[model samples]
Target chain A: SQELEQSPQSLIVQEGKNLTINCTSSKTLYGLYWYKQKYGEGLIFLMMLQKGGEEKSHEKITAKLDEKKQQSSLHITASQPSHAGIYLCGADRSASKIIFGSGTRLSIRP
Target chain B: GAGVSQSPSNKVTEKGKDVELRCDPISGHTALYWYRQRLGQGLEFLIYFQGNSAPDKSGLPSDRFSAERTGESVSTLTIQRTQQEDSAVYLCASSPVGTDTQYFGPGTRLTVL
Candidate 1:
């Protein structure tokens, strides 16, 4: 079975600061997805990376898949209170089901 | 267009009881999935249905957990003899036939007492 590990289980940062969260997989990644969830709410899709060395950005957030495809990072530039949520990384295993990381809890101080 | 929708956003039941969670996938979607998310944990895959093929039940935690999808539209996940460990948020996702990106529902939070 494949597993995903996220770093910095929880983070607290100033509203204007920048932060990065990482997701590492035990095996080569096929399809990697980033999602955000407000406390106790449903997940909101952020982005998806398939090809190695692929990088995509949306608004103030950027995601990059490593050349090896086993690691991915999500960077938030000038984070705001709205960026405070649980960030999860999911990998498509066997092209059937998605396995998710434990998620990184982010908090922004105003 | 409406994303995936789930019914009874929250559910509470006693031990040894049975509970059903429903999910309505997006129109024309060909794949549906069920997952469980425990408190402060990651989402765990439970079952998956694609088109008319047999469902992939390899992720189900136990025999007490089962799910069914009518065509490619609605799906229901039933947990029989629910235990305290079964208390979690049940989530449903759906995707198109050729895509792997799944849109999630609001999820049904189940609590077993």
Candidate 2:
């Protein structure tokens, strides 16, 4: 079975600072996804990366897949309170199943 | 367009009881999936359904957990003889036939006492 590991299990940063969260997979990744959840709410899709060396950004957040396709990183520039949430990385284990990382809890101090 | 929707946002049941959670996928989505998220943990895949083909039940934790999808519209996950370990948020996701990006529902929080 494939597994995903996220670094910095929990992080606290100033509202204006920048931070990066990393996700590494034990197996070669074919498809990787990033999602954000506010406390107990549902997950909100952020972005997806399929090809190696691919990078995508939305607003102030950016995600990049490594050339080896086994690691991905999400960077937040000038984080805000709205960016405080649980960030999870999911890897496609098969066509229909996705295995998720334990998740990184992010908090922003105003 | 509406995203995936789930019913009974929260559920409370006793041990040894049976519970059913419902999910309504987006219109025209041919793939549906069920997952469980425990407290402070990531999502765990439970089952997957694609169109009329047999569902992939390899992720189901045990025989007590089962799910069914009617056509490509609605899916129901049932837990029989639930235990305390069964307490978690049950989530459902759906996507188009050719895509792997899934949209998730609000999820049903189940508590077993």
Candidate 3:
């Protein structure tokens, strides 16, 4: 089984400040996905990184896959209250399976 | 296009009872997946169905949990003899063929007392 460890179980950031969340994997991540979820709601896909050293951004959120493909980071610039949510990282493994990390709860303060 | 939909947004069941959750995938999606998310935890894969291929049940916690998907459409996840530990948010997702992106449904929250 593939194991993914996410750092900073919870984060509190001030509005307009930048923040970063990290997801690390013990095995190679063929595909890494970033998602946001409000408590008791469904997950919203943010981005997916496949190739090593690849980076993708959407609005103020940016995700990058490391050259080794074992780590991925999500950076949010000029964070706002709307950016507060639980950030989760998922890895697509063999046999078409996807495993997710425990998730990081992000709270943005005004 | 309409996103994935799930029925019985929240279900409260007694111990040893049976609960069934339904999911309707987006039109033309060939792959569907089921996952469970416990409070303060991440999503745990339950099962997966891709087209007409055999479903993968490796992630299922026990035999009391079973799921079925019909052709590329609706899916039902049945939990027999529900236990308190079974309480969680059951999520369903679907993706297009050859695409790794998964679109999720609002999820069915099951509370077994």
Candidate 4:
């Protein structure tokens, strides 16, 4: 019954390595957002893309929405240990509702 | 100096007890939403409040769950006769009208015994 699907449910990378996480939706997304959460903490907004073929970046993290509007990717450049956490992708069909992906657990070792 | 705020960061209650969780959205935010996240699961939409006309309660799992937002500012989610399965981290988020970015509050962790 889950609509948003994310790959590599869990990932581990060495410091300075790059990593990517992908999210695909069964239904078209009107708005796609990326968030990061530390264990037991609230989610921090990373980026939001509303238009297809749109891309945005924050710090070392960059996110892109494909032209199909049903898929998105989040890439981290030169990953750091601090970047380790749970990454979540949420699709909002409208401002009223959002469906979340089963987060990607990222761990970085130095 | 202000963001969405939730109360009683942790709550542990016995089965069949009722519980109320509170959220105070940022000033001037017109859109508010509630979500629940179970262990090892993604967040699930619970309810939404937009300017107090009427809330979208489509996500409520059962009649035992209900929520109310007062005057477009604060919201309270009430669970009547909570069951053991009603344990999760309940998150509250607020956004201004027509915006996609939502600011989330540290959720309330509810544990039913």
Clashing pairs for model 1 are: none
DockQ of candidate 4? 0.05
Please state what fraction of the native interface contacts candidate 3 reproduces.
0.00
Model 1: lDDT equals 0.85
**Can you tell me which runs of candidate 1 are displaced by over 4 Å?**
A1-110
Candidate 4 wrongly placed segments (more than 4 Å): A1-110
Query: Model 1 TM-score?
Result: 0.55
lDDT score, residue A61, model 4? Answer: 92
Each candidate's chain A: what TM-score? 0.96, 0.96, 0.95, 0.95
Docking class of 2: incorrect
TM-score of each: 0.55, 0.55, 0.56, 0.55
For every candidate, the chain B TM-score is 0.98, 0.98, 0.98, 0.97
Off-target runs (Cα >4 Å) in candidate 2 are A1-110
Tally clashing residue pairs in candidate 3: 0
Candidate 1 CAPRI level: incorrect
> What TM-score describes the B chain of model 1?
0.98
- Candidate 3 lDDT by residue in tens digits, A1-110: 32889978899999999999999998998878888866433466688888999999999999999999999999999999999888989876542244677788899999
lDDT of 2 at B102: 67
